[model samples]
Target: MVLAAAGCSENAMYDLDGGAMDAAVVEARSLEIVGDPTVSLAGGDTADLTVQLRDPSGAPLAGETVRFALDGRAHDSTLETVTATTDAMGLAHSALQAGTVVAAFRVRASADDAASVSFDVAVGDAGFGSMQVTPEYVGERETLPRVVVGLFADADCEDDFVRRDPGDRLQVLSEDDELVRFLGLPAGVSFAVAVRAEGEGGTVLAWGCEDRIAVEALETTDVDVTFDDEPLVVDGSYQTTSVFPTTTGEDVATALEGARDALLPASDATLILDAAEATLSGAEATELRAARASGFDATYQTALESLGPAAAHEALIDRLRTELTSLTVVGRLRATEGELDFSVLRLGMGAGELEVALTELTIETSLDATLDSEELRVSELLIDLSASELVRALATREAFDRLLDGPSAWLASAASCAALPPPEEPIGCDAVCLQAACRTVLADYWTAALTVIEALDQERSTLELDGSANVADLAGDLQVDTLEGSLAGEWTGPSATSPEALEGTFSGERITPPR
Candidate 1:
């Protein structure tokens, strides 16, 4: 049987016999304009435009050809029709150049039997101008050796006015000379210029604004920009000391006196005749006898005799040191922040030996403070404590023991003392025993680590931080995956100085370990 064939519409489905089928068909449904829809340009400047085509299902329609047409109240001879083929992503690109006359125009992109999208372009007069930027150094070699300059229509430098039409801003690289010149700017327009070094992010090294620059029809307007390069140097030091709650001076003194009384010999018969005669009178001897008969003495005399008075004093000092924590920080300021290097040391003291548990860290931080309020917000904190020296110091001390052993053992001892019944005396054997044990252990394990110091650099591994301050009060929180910690304390001294001076007492606790 022979069948008649029928032609299909542009987007209609077809059968094998070339007959129009009733099946559903997909067609281009939308045209989207990409890039900047509104552009400002000086006469003779050209800008690229893009259009995107999509099917009824919102999927890109590729391999399609799109034609562009320009429309305006008064058209220039340079405005001409152009065509571009859509790529795999359905994007078609075309270029438009402004004419010598200043006017506003619209460009439309259309596909065969598809919706069209339009973009607006504004053209200014053919007049042109130039700007000359000169660096005025406040001190010797004040300016950076290399910098990039950006000219904007607004004072914020957020909008690039010099190159508003097509290409990047006119960024002149300042080399041997201090003057950088930008040419071909839209004449008679006010502009704000900002100078900054590469890799500085958005920090502005220098900035200025030219209110107005007059450019006659064919003549060039020359504008001069002078920027002062002033170097700001800020350096300071801060110190802090902290005494543990359970190991205060008053507690230690009472413990020592109780220990002495407990160790005294009891009866005249049991006392060493010669030793007692030399150290105590008859009345004192009777009192010592009374103290021994009472239950207050337990191993006190044996400990005193075995360790000796000097060793006992040394042990006490060592114990006290272990309970004390201190921190010292020094920093040099740059821009809005400062680079700080700090060390926290837990001191252990003995008769003839001294030991320390040390941790060294470096951080970049900024201080935000005002005279009106006592609160100071500390921000932009980047910390690093991964130097080999820091590792070695930590390895030699008990500061990191919390990571391995969990909560400190001293805390447990303190809890045990708290559980005991209140004694008639301020201090008793339970507290004294724990303090003595801590002293003995520290003395036995005392060893010094070789100190190694190195300059701080940003390339090293660093952690972020958040903190706050109030006049003499300060607190900081460390943020890191493997380590969690905090620094809190009070400080005193001059608020603002060349090298801002600070004296304070600080305490820190490690919540986690790197391992």
Candidate 2:
């Protein structure tokens, strides 16, 4: 997220080389401040300073780093230093210690552009005095709040347990060395908190614990502290790499370099991913859960329409079923009565654009289809033409071309039915032979027509064709009315799936061919 001001210096904003952006990137900017030199400070105590970071516009700057300094000194062993990192929320905190202190901060642009911000702050005890030590680590059931947790820490109360009042209070409690102050917590947890020492004990003034807490089943008692007199007590306060039962610290660190054999390859582990698309809904999730068993992949695509014919169509379906049964989610666990479903809500390509994109073969089609898993129920499907290109395709076959060459060739070849019994021919072998020859000649036509009909009847989906009434009966040189019940003019699928044979009737006049 970038913050910008309406009127700020042109140099206020510059692009960062690579950063995590909260939203779209339109501008990059930061804030700068300069304070009057009158700020005062006290010795041996800390104060507070605040800096505003904003974008090129007067708007507050976010994600800036403000280093703290007094005089021209840096974090050398000879000098002390304080620093603050700006947060996404655009706030920075500076610690002021006792003594004559002047506060200032500088921001340097990251790898992207050369941009920077610098500000000066005057320091003094002219501010509030308090110190609060907060636990840095919080796990399940952890009560330490991240907000303003250290706002009221008392600087003087060493060896004190910081407590937040039930009603707007935070204070260091029990700094007396005689009694140890600690917060009582439950079992099975770890915590990271700071403990201070006020007494004149050792050369080491006071120190804070490390980040993060890792506790086994806790003894379920209060947090305790120990002195350098018996430094072994600090061992109870923190866990080392050599935690009792786990491999020693050295072993685990070595494990990162493959020195230890405990690590497993990513592919060897069983992974069950619970994935859901953003467009999917709760109902879809429920349906997906049903498919949880086995290796089903629930997805929807309209590509099935590209399957050319029965042989290819069946083969594609078989592959889909096989793949579905082989995949698994949730580590091979199966759900009974699952529904591996897909929806047609996605784009429909079978109509036109999709057909062109799918294959090299030009599918002269008028088929529009809708199918579900239960049955190949179709809303509409049709075939358009059995014209030249089509006839050649079918007719190229050695034995069956005539049957595929459109209804004209079909009618001509089968017209032997028109012949009547020859008078006086019954007694002769020639007469008997004529009937047999006609049957033999038309045998292929009957087989061809029956094959087409059976396929249409058994097809689970619809197939519409645009067969025009212009097909000419060559023998008579006349165009017959379009085949009525047989639906020669176009393809159609079952009207109701329950009775698969009942299909929509296809009728047409001598329609003009498409341009």
Candidate 3:
């Protein structure tokens, strides 16, 4: 009898050990669930989970694999298992899952150190479900990295709850998979938030940007979630979404102006020209003019190339240069909403200013657009100036009529050839006649200019004359000691033309009154 009892006892003890190993230590992430947890999951829908494994003492246990099963026959499979390993304290977790049925979940985990632990499995008969919301905070000139929010349900809300993300990899989950409440984002961005609600067993309701949270530098806005059944449904659901702004600021005017001044001749070149042109004599004056023109051309290109880092003055110079060539103006911008206005000149194609504007310049895009908005891509940059006005302004009014008369036409003609190539092609070389032609053209231009000048309505705008006819006459009779070598004159538009018009009076080089 003793021998039989011993054998029986040993067998019972072995069975007991096996039973302990198969027992499950199961847990949910948090108590006092915040929202309706029951949800209908479609075939591919994913739900977040927060699970825990522990011993009876509430101490976490380790190395646990939990198997999940659904009761409904329509489930892809009634048996689906997930393996989890506990931390040093024996605490382990399983993320939430989206399943076909709400009331069909059963979970169990191994609870022992010897390949398994003694434990128990716990599951809700109503099943796991949850709803959530998050807010995104953004800034100007800065990227909006991430956003989060929380949800709250009425006292009548059910306790059946699951998290939105299991590992919180998709979103950072603190105590639960769902963070329906929001807090703490820096002042650099603007934000809007929203929530997702798991409706019934087979349905999910989503609320887009239901919450607009503008997190400022020093404060956090309120995050509240409330919902109603617009259709007079049996249950109520709620959710919210988040949006943000990426940039902000005040000094756009200064920024744009700084961008402009960079388009000119170097400050150093301006200084050099000033110093060099100061003491020039008659002969030196001619030399200075040639040198100045060459210097300007070379320095202008260099300055234009260096525009990316120029000051305001340089920008002004660049704008002036725009009047010197051909270009297009694409669009304009206002840095300060009401404080400033500007137009951007788009340089046309090829070796001139257009190519220059294409060079990279480091300007903050948000100076005009939202920080999150696209960069203010500029294919061309230039200063706006009126070439036509410059043309009109440079004409000499008072002296135009005189140069077109008698021998003066001939001398002026020669001077014109000396200054610029004739605009059109012609035959028969006659120096005297050519000189007269220059005088005539110059007269026409000046008169046209005078017409423009009257329109300007400016007081003292002036121009210089290259006076004319015979070389000898220019060198002698017209060369009165009292007369300045340079003939400079100023004029405005003629209300009427001179009563005395000129006719050909002297051979080739002279301007004569027309009879």
Error of 2 at 292 (Å): 99
Pairing residues by index, what is the TM-score of model 2? Answer: 0.16
Which runs of model 1 end up more than 4 angstroms from their true locations? 1-96, 99-126, 135-146, 153-168, 198-206, 216-259, 262-314, 318-515
Ranking by TM-score: 1, 3, 2
Pull out the clashing pairs in model 1. 240-504, 240-505, 240-506, 241-505, 241-506, 266-289
Q: Model 3, residue 493: what's the lDDT?
A: 24
- For lDDT, candidate 2 versus 3, the one ahead is 3
lDDT for 149 (candidate 2): 17
Query: Which ten contiguous residues of candidate 3 have the minimum total lDDT?
Result: 240-249
Candidate 2: global Cα-lDDT?
A: 0.26
Name the regions of candidate 2 deviating beyond 4 angstroms.
Answer: 1-28, 34-38, 57-64, 70-83, 100-515
- TM-score (all chains, Cα) for each model: 0.34, 0.16, 0.20
lDDT of 3 by residue, 1-515 (tens): 00111112322211111121111222221111112223233334544323445555556545654433222112231222465555665544444444333222222233333222211111222222332343332322122111223222111122223123211101222222224422222222223333323222312232223323334433444544433211111111111111111010011123323443332224433432343344345765565456556555354325334321122233323333433232222223332222322233232211222221332221111112110011122222222222233322211111132343322232233233333222122222223333343344434333443344333324212211112221112212221111111111122222323111111111112122111
Each model's lDDT:
0.39, 0.26, 0.27
The order by descending lDDT is 1, 3, 2
Cα RMSD of all models vs. native, in order, equals: 18.6, 32.0, 28.8
